[model samples]
Target: MSHSKHSSLSHDRHPLNFQDTYICPICRHGHIESLTLMDVFACDFCRHIFTANLKDQSIHVENSSQPMTWRWTGRNWQAANQLDVDLTVVIWLVSVSLVILPPSLIWLSSHAFPPLVGSSGSWFPAFWVGLTFTLHFLFVSWLMAEHYQFPLYVSTKVRLRRLLDRR
Candidate 1:
């Protein structure tokens, strides 16, 4: 069984985005049939068919509907991941510089040691501050990614078409 239905109730009536259009069952290609409330669309092209039940919003596609072509619109997740990683690295660098480096330099200057080679006592506070900032940034980034669906929205499109004879 397909995980998602090809139709969207939001786009009813228009031919391009018709919610209840009938398609051929054999070839998985759309047929010329105009769908009505009583009729289920059947693909004549590739042994696919589907219908929406009136009483309860149930979308039923027959066994033949298994092999129908599925299309989708969304960002490529792998590409998005690459971009996320880049962003993460940039953030990490910024955090190290702004949060970790400056304070360490100040604390080091207070003691008798090199600014870059951080003193022992200064290490503790620096570590804590860096850890806290990193954790906080990570959490904010995670929340933003979740809320925004991290890069893009993922959606699918399926249609039934007639299996025409090529010979």
Candidate 2:
């Protein structure tokens, strides 16, 4: 729904065909659940997981070497929560646009304003404008990086997998 560049990819770019199907990661059977967010086919029968990203396909097979396990996190479950990677990308794009676009329009406006153009004064105003612009850009960049840097759902899954494997 967002006008962000990554919006399409985040929401509905890769529609998965659950019926086309792939092998289950756990039982090695041919029944896998299409988990588009994780970009993987998950085995419902044995809880195995694998990803079929365009770059490469990696399988997380359920075997003696890597057993399956699950855990509880004290948070309400939601589709948006599960799709953190996509959500983060969308947020980053929107935030960057918001930060850069408005000030740019204003800067252009000052140039177009004939009354404000002809006269010049101290360098202090220009210095202040540059300082504010830099601060705003830096602030938005930091926020975007912080928001997308750690997708909670994926990190949680990875942590749970590690814990389960240990036991």
Candidate 3:
């Protein structure tokens, strides 16, 4: 009875078949299939096209006109030409500029022409000045990030962990 049950279970449909499914490097999905074009594979999950190199026996993912070659780093695929910039650095620089520029300008303007501005008795309070600076800083930072193609945030914890590893 045990042998019969085992045989029946083996014949049943399995979730994965090794021969048909290929693992996708981009999404880590296993539903990649070869397209009609020879040496080309497409991952529906990630919507990425992959080209198979026969000589090297490696898969290349198409990134625009240039194909970015990736290598399996034991566990994950890493692109050979990864040009990622640290967004934290950009944000830090922008924040520092915002903190310094507006206050300095306000001080300089008031000092340069004290009688005209100060005698008017219409100076903004500290809270309003700070609020205006904050709003302006946020808008400028967002615009700069969008214009320069910089991400607002990136997960660099993995890279930091790797660097901190002693062994």
Candidate 4:
């Protein structure tokens, strides 16, 4: 007799009401409130607009470049159209490419374009190799730090810029 196919939201005392405020799925820090009498909702923190499907118990971001949908699962919101990507495969591919691509490109370029006549070939190639390796190392380090949730404060950089703001 309930309307929702997933659960009919039967667990709830009643269906979601327009007056109800739910956590913004896009920006977890913000709260979503109904926009006037329309079916649209807006997040206070991220200023994202979302459309709600009360019957299906799903909501989708309207203002984002890539609108994503999430369904209320009684206890929490779950991604509705989330892809089935394997984390290990993704990590391995990215890591391997980071380690291999730059060096291969450097090697191929050195072979293809010989140094100009009288140009200092020795120091330039060494410098290029060192710079490439250092850049690759930094990229890999940042990726691992992000993926593993390293104890290091993520302010990392996102917050340093905010230092000018009054506390």
* Each candidate's clash count: 28, 0, 0, 0
lDDT of each: 0.39, 0.47, 0.53, 0.67
Best by TM-score: 4
Q: Rank the candidates by lDDT, best first.
A: 4, 3, 2, 1
Where does model 1 exceed 4 Å of error?
A: 1-15, 18-119, 152-167
Residue runs of model 4 more than 4 Å from their true location after superposition? 1-15, 84-100, 107-167
Question: On a 0 to 1 TM-score scale, where does candidate 4 land against the true structure?
Answer: 0.54
Candidate 2, residues 56-108, lDDT tens digits: the string is 22333333232222211111111221335787588778877767776676566
Model 4, position 117, has a per-residue lDDT of 62
What RMSD, rounded to one decimal, does every model reach?
A: 16.3, 16.9, 13.3, 8.9
Residue-level lDDT tens digits of model 3 in 5-94: 243234443232212335566555333567764557676555567776535545676743444565534333455545446765786687
Best candidate according to lDDT? 4
Off by over 4 Å in 3: 1-20, 63-67, 72-78, 82-167
Task: After the best TM-score superposition of candidate 4, give how far the Cα of residue 66 lies from its true spot, in angstroms.
Answer: 1.6
TM-score each candidate. Answer: 0.25, 0.32, 0.37, 0.54
